[model samples]
Target: MSSDALWYFARGSGVVSLILLTVVVALGIGARSGRPAFGLPRFAVNLVHRNAALLSVVFLGAHVTTLLFDEYANLRAVDLVVPFIGNYSPFWQGLGTVALDLLLAIVVTSLLRHRIGVRAWRTVHWAGYLSWPIALAHGLGAGSDADTWWLWTISLACLAVVVAAVVWRTSAAFEARTDRAVRRVEPRLRAGIR
Candidate 1:
């Protein structure tokens, strides 16, 4: 209803967007692990990941829209498309724009995945790994409450969750590969080919 409310909304939505992005990334890693997450099936994990990603986009839209409307930030339309051009916190704001660009690319490619082929879709999707960190950096650097302890706590939690997921995924992949290799080699050894 007022500028103050708009500012608060922007900040709140930005935080929520970051949280949602973290969930999406974690769920993606879980999906790759070939194991169920939270006792849920792989398909369920995938569904949650897709839904969380969409929700992040929604909150991001709110964050950007409110920032543009809030006169204090002095955000320009160009700032949304082109990174680093904004006079207000240029570097930090630019990182947010870059993150947004990467996210949009991933979303667009995902939507057109059937047409783009699996390789192209997967290559673009990998940007999710990069997007989350850029977003976290933007929040820490550009956010007005960056210095707050609560924000730090939340950021750390997000970081921990993602790190754990990645570690789990990597180990699972290695084990699967090792199992396949063992299977192949064992058959050859039994046949006296090794």
Candidate 2:
């Protein structure tokens, strides 16, 4: 395939990846809301997010796979993980490498959550926020399709959702902290803890 085609292809796949990441973020917030989130809404949100994440990863795999097929892009599968090696575009190629690394970390952390424990899983999963931006940058910088109006529109939508999710997570964390402070002061709460 032509270099232009490969660039457009990666851009499209990158958008799907971003959308999946957003779903995962939404699920993560629900999971943090304590036991109160055991209801259907929380369950659905978590389910969709998890499924989306998996799908995103799948599309990412396809995106990388296609890069190899597109001879003009001159990318190998390893370059998907290695960065700076995709002969299609070297200077900006490393961004994909960084994003892929972050994604790998998240997947490993998630798979090991049961064995490593929830706290460890949480610490690693927090990397998702940073991964979002890195992925976006990779798409925009290395993408052959970056200049398309449709691509720009989709990119903006992804950015909006990411920002909203971050805001919600921050708000939830603050509320949780506030609640903990109040609970810490109440004699009943202290007794329950003990």
The local distance difference test score of each candidate is 0.92, 0.73
lDDT of 2 by residue, 78-117 (tens): 7867778667677577887788788888899899889999
The C-alpha stretches of model 2 lying farther than 4 A from their native spots are 1-11, 29-31, 35-40, 171-194
- Number of the top candidate by lDDT? 1
TM-score for each predicted model, relative to the true structure? 0.87, 0.75
Model 1, range 84-192, lDDT digits (tens) per residue? 9998999999999999999999989999999999999999999998999999999999999999999999999999999988886678665786588689789899999
For model 1, how many clashes? Answer: 0
Worst 10-residue lDDT window, candidate 2: 33-42
lDDT of candidate 2 vs native?
A: 0.73
